[model samples]
Target: MRATFHLKTLTVAIAAFSVASAASAAGLDRSGQDVTAFLQDGLYAEAVYTYIDGDVSGHDNAYIGPDKKAYEQGKKIDDIAESYDFFRYGVKADINDTFSVGILYDEPFGAAADYSGDNNFVARGDLDASVNAISGGKASSAADAGLKIGQLTAGATQAGAAAANFAAQAQTATTPQAAAGFAEQAQAAQTQAQTLAGQAQSLGAAVAAARAEAATTGEGTNVEVRTESVTGILGMKLGENKNFQVYGGPVMQQVQADVALRGIAYGPATGYTTHISSDQDYGWLAGVSYSKPEIALLAALTYRSEIDHSLNIDETYPLVAALGGDPVQGNKIDITTPKSVNFDFQTGVNQTTLATAKVRWVPWTDFAIVPPLYNEVSKRSTGDDKGLPLVSYDEDQWLVELGLAKRLSPALAVTGTVGWDSGAGDPVTSLGPIEGYYSAGLGAKYNLTENWAVSAGGKYLWFGDAQGQIPTKTIVSDFDSNDGYALGVKVSYQAK
Candidate 1:
């Protein structure tokens, strides 16, 4: 009886072990497993978390001239815009040796805010007519003075000649009294002409001075518009093997934008107040990935479809508008954000090292926000000429990453990586923010048991200068930015 019992016990143990192995394998086939997650696991399964934050700023200055003598100084001018922020979070789970799933949430795109009002370019009534008017007036006055001077000088010369001839005749004996009277008249005429000529010279000198000053000064009108945006995304993944995976999710996006005039004051008497408000939008994304572990090669392609949105915009003006002020009104706008494509790849170098690369393209040229028809018909509508021009926004970007990992213990490991992105420059749109540069990251993982694990990591991204066009006709310069940081945490449980 003892021998039989031993045999049964051994068989049961073997069956249990086989069942656990099968379960683990099944878990690996789900969608959440990724190359990064796989590498983190080789180190150990540890609870992980991540976060990211950053900002961008720049300016545009423009000079306009109506004529050679009456040119406006820099008309459109915008100082460095308000700073921006970015954030993200991610989590992962390992079902078994081959199956895993995870979720990632982040804000991938954003915009800056412009608020400086130094130039009188945009504001109505800020236009300087003094220089142009004074310059032209001076030129006209100088011409008239020249004409008067010429006439007076000629008359004086002619009168002097006639007086001499009359004197000569008088000296020859005929009428002395008549000749004396003629001489007196001629002298008086000469004196009057000289006085008039002096007056004309004085006026001419004043006009020349005025013209000189106008030549050195510049004046013109300018306009500037500021806009800000925030995007939030949530994604879920399910992976069953190193070969196939799927991810899909929803997003919430918000934008707070405004158009205002610089170098202009707002008051009850001025009938001009700024338009300030916010708009909210929604979007979603889904995709799949395929990887080959044996070959140490991986490829992930993702498509983010576009989102259609309508904004309930509130237009506000001075209270005087309500109290018998100019035509004032408020309304909503309809706009659409563009879609994008993301392709990422990874290749293992050795047991402890790996290489990674990625490419992304965003179709922002299709983005537009337009006011309703009724609002357009309203005289109070501020939407006229507010449409963004169509520009080629086709962006082809690339990134490369190199990483090394070290095993600290049987159940713990650590990794470090560095990467470079070469793509941010001369972007389209007045407010599109583009940043590209170097990034460094550190990650750690811990194995809670044979079937459970967790991981955590942090990354810092340093961006180079970003450039774009502004409505002010000025090239926003000194467009440098600071470093961004991201912190991430994830946990995984294995069934086998």
Candidate 2:
């Protein structure tokens, strides 16, 4: 006989995972954009909360910018990954056996990071007094170094002239004793001059390097993005047994962001900043589903279209302004969120066990953020009149997860899962420098009453190694062996 008893645990586990699989996802994916709630047999509603934290740290590149030797020691970078959290709500109601209506809410896409500590990513003060102004650990403050170097060079020149005068006197000496005394004085003066000259050369190089460091790094690199979405779906049952269904709905989304680019990592693009005001946009989603309740089988495929937004922005690029580029104001930036696909499936393994699989894909390469003034100023350096976007990716993203759920008792259930996410790409943007991750998770659900259930879950992620780069694709940092975790809780109600 087909298994039916394991359905409750499987359903709860899937819902909980939809919330846990965020933050560490490739690109800016969050909440998994799940729609399974609408596939339930009757009335259902759920509220979920998830929190995530990642330990992302690495070393700065030694060979970035004209001061290639400044960071030879590759200073340590402090943890840049900031903790993130969000909420999701879903509600669904079946009208007869052939019609269903549902609404879902989630914070679907976002990013957060901050650069701190002694790394080049942080802004330095004047080369003489700034902490970020370092050159092979030997550079001093600008005032101190320049003064000392000046004194050494001047002293060396004086000593050289004195040596020449002494040698000339020796050449004209009338007595052997006088000639010996003059030659000895000449030798001592020449030795002093040579020693000072060598010292000046070494110190001069160090001070120049410090100055270069100060010029290339002006602010810490950081980014924060937030978005909220609400989707309304209406599903129709097909087939005589109503085992198949098709559904779609409109999606409303609001988004905002703040970004700053800094450090030798960004080269001439350092000291760039942008603020995108919150803007609301619309899109659509459609999907198909099949179910066999007797065997606890369900399969669904969903597609969400990209939303286009024209948002007001504020921007500043010191490099551009210094070069006499026109100031930009009251401009609208056009951004199109990436589209995505999610396929989810589950089937009963026995009377008390169920197996599940989820797969997701996003075309991250097609998405980018291009600030107008930044692009325009870039033409002076590069002949490409089209310029370049301030931020973009080189590859698409894919994620897969597999798991099993077991009903331990009539009112209790447990689940476990393993997942993999293909990050946007290696050598990713310095703001979010990770190549993707592998994850393991566990969840438990307990029915408080016949119609009320509470569930909790947690996931541990092992992040992949990657090189952090600037928009121009110059490698400036390295991150490896980083990790993170996620925790989630959900309260749900359903009536059949």
Candidate 3:
């Protein structure tokens, strides 16, 4: 009985790399429903910590003007995204042969971005300054000046032609006064032509100066997002052999976000600071598990419902102060997390080897966050009757993984995996700019004693090209050929 239980423990232990490999998949989804998987039968407790680091650097190929580009070539922005860390801890215990319970704590979603370097386009004041310089009547002013100049030139030309005809007539005129009148008109027409030309030159020069000034005053920005979740589960066994079970419970989560907009690319968001926080939002989970000890087979299917949050937001728009409007606004907003389904299966190929496969599906398209006042103001400004949300997902996401685990000794086991994610979308939001991923993982577990074990896992992910977009589907930046690494360490103890 002890040997059989040990092999089962080894099977679950070696597959720990599945969590590490999931760090690179769809929309801030670092945990991948692993909390449910972690609640499998056993008097077990474990803690896992993971670290993720990635960098995206590329030039902005979008043309701003004849003389300026979005982000200059050869100027690389390193560490645009700060490294993030995750910690999860859980405990599961069997109350009897037919009942089990567990609780887990984890961070499910987060994001961070900073643009601080001198070479960073946003940091260098390109976006806001550009908006201010051009949007402040400069273009219209220049166009008006050009139109006036054109009209003046046409008048001057007609007057000059008339003057020439008069001069020719003067040469054969009957009186000296008529001859003098013709000469004066000819000189006046020439002076008017020169004056209009001079005004056009002045207007052109002013536009150039304003544009140069706009390119010079922006500061960098820092954005941070955080979430915390707690889940509780109770499982009950059924069937004559107790091989079938069902588990479910409530989930609570807290979320907070702060964004500082400093660049012109953000448009109205420029010079604005927005914040939102929600606590104790609730969701639920349900699943069924089937196992056959004789064949060493296990399969589980789990569903997690979306959590809705009503958040009170505090926003400050410094530009509003300049316009003699309110600088700060307080309002409520609604946001929802995506619903997901997860499936996990494992079977023993032999006494020493096991095979595992897992799949996760998240309906991201229905997820969105729209702050009330911000939405109202934005729609009015853009003349859109229906306002756009602050953030939204355009498509659903999928993740698939396959792996093999082998026992090297009674106390040692190893595993390797390959995975793929279909991603949330191609042109994604700038806040969490990432595409799908292709990944590989490796992990090892060593049993220090009959009741304690330690495991470490690492994964490498190659991300697809990502295009970051604004609310109106404008592509601001492209991240090509980016990749990241995730490392996880876990420790577990089992009750005797």
Candidate 4:
């Protein structure tokens, strides 16, 4: 007979490494959407807290104009990645040998970033008529001023030409009566020319004054997004020995955000801002699992469906107000969250050792946030009525992690993991300017008693380099050699 080994009582803490994989994920992916807590043996309950922080900084593009009068481009952008954190709680109970139920809560998807320092992302109140800027007689927002200037100049030219023609007719008239009539027309034409010229000068002064007041007061670009989810699950064990199980449940989620677009990098879209009111919606998740206690093995595959939401959004664009429309518009937009697939597997290698692996995929390329007002305003510049969304991803995301756990003592276990995340795209959104990351983590779990335990873990991330692009697919910045970290702690209880 062959000898067999089971690590049910020694290496169960192997799940600890999976808790903080959120430190380096793609496409607004956070929390890793982990469901391992619900898979624990018997009645189990756990609460996990994780924190992430990074310094994402780079240089802004720069170009100076000729004649030494204009200098635009080549400036430094400060750290934009703000400190972020969240919490997760899960409780599971077995009603009998063949049925189980559980509830889980987690903040799954989000982002937070702010641009500061002397960069294009900040709002400047100074507009130079010499330089092509808002109200510089070049940008579309200055259309009214440009048109008025053109009309006044044209009127003055027409009046002067008419005066010259009438004066010549007065000089050559055969009769004094006809000459007086022509002379009167010439004098009136000269007066009209003077009046138009004076008006033209006044209009020019007014445009200069407006340009002086073009500078607005405010901070630079910034964005904050948050989401919350709660899931209720029911599982039924099938077949003899109850080794195979199928489970699924409904998920409730809420999302909200605030955004500000400032500075010259956005061109006419500068000073644009948006607010998304908190919206709650529903979705469903399904999965299947198999286990073999003799070898201490478990494998499961899960799928989460996309949730639909009607988000109420308010937007403000400087150009919209310039184009004779309300600066702020409030409307509702239809948005659907992305769907995902997750696979988890673990098995005991020996009496005191365990091996584990996890893989996750999200179709982010199919996701986009298209605010109606922003899209409509974009049509004038893009010339395509289809317009563009304020935010979107260029690629899907794939994350893979492998881990090992070993029992160090009767009541303690240690775990280690190495992971890789494929970011949403190479040239990602300017808001979150990192492509993805490579990560490594270490964790330990100590059992205090038969029903209680504590686990803590930390991960160090090496972010991948990427180019940041705005909605028009314009590359304005580059972020490279950046890094971040994630830390997590969990308190767990089990009654097996």
TM-score versus the correct structure, for each prediction: 0.49, 0.80, 0.79, 0.83
Clashes of each: 40, 2, 3, 7
Least accurate 10 contiguous residues by lDDT in model 3 = 65-74
> Tens digit of lDDT per residue, candidate 2, span 1-496?
4336446545543435555756545778777787877777789998889999999999988652344323343889988999988999999999888999999999889999999877768766455543223332333455666677798899999999999999999999999999999999999999999989866654564454344446655457899999999999999999998999999999999999999876545544556688999999999999999998767899999999999999998987655443455444447899899999999998888777778899999999999988887777666445588887877888899999988877778778788889999999987888888988999998888888878888888999999888887666667788988999999998989998
Task: List residue ranges in candidate 3 displaced over 4 A.
Answer: 1-15, 36-39, 65-76, 118-121, 125-129, 132-218, 322-324
Off by over 4 Å in 4: 1-3, 63-73, 129-215
Clashing pairs for model 2 are 128-141, 128-142
lDDT of every model, 2 decimals? 0.41, 0.79, 0.70, 0.80
- Model 1 residue runs over 4 Å out of place are 1-104, 112-242, 245-284, 293-298, 316-328, 369-414, 418-435, 440-462, 466-468, 472-496
Compared to the true structure, candidate 3 yields what TM-score? Answer: 0.79
Can you write out model 3's per-residue Cα lDDT over 335-384, one digit (the tens) per residue? 78878898988877777778888899988888877766557656744567
Give the range of the ten consecutive residues with the poorest summed lDDT in model 2: 130-139
Give the top-scoring candidate (TM-score): 4
Deviating ranges (above 4 Å) for candidate 2: 1-15, 65-73, 128-219, 326-328
**Which is superior by lDDT, 1 or 4?**
4
Q: What RMSD, rounded to one decimal, does every model reach?
A: 19.1, 11.9, 10.9, 9.1
lDDT of 1 by residue, 1-496 (tens): 2111221111111111000000000000101112233222222222323333544444332322223222222433444334332323344555554545554443344333444444322223311332222233322444564565577567756655665665565566457777777667666655665665554444443333333323322322211222222222222334655466665556565554444322221111122223335555667666666756543455777766666656665443332233243335566566565666666665544443344554545544355444332223222212454432212243434445555555456567666767665542444333433445577777766667665656666667776565443332223233455455555655665432
- Pairs that collide in candidate 3 are 125-218, 127-264, 128-264
> Local error of candidate 3 at 340, Å?
1.1
Q: Least accurate stretch of 10 residues (summed lDDT) in model 1?
A: 19-28
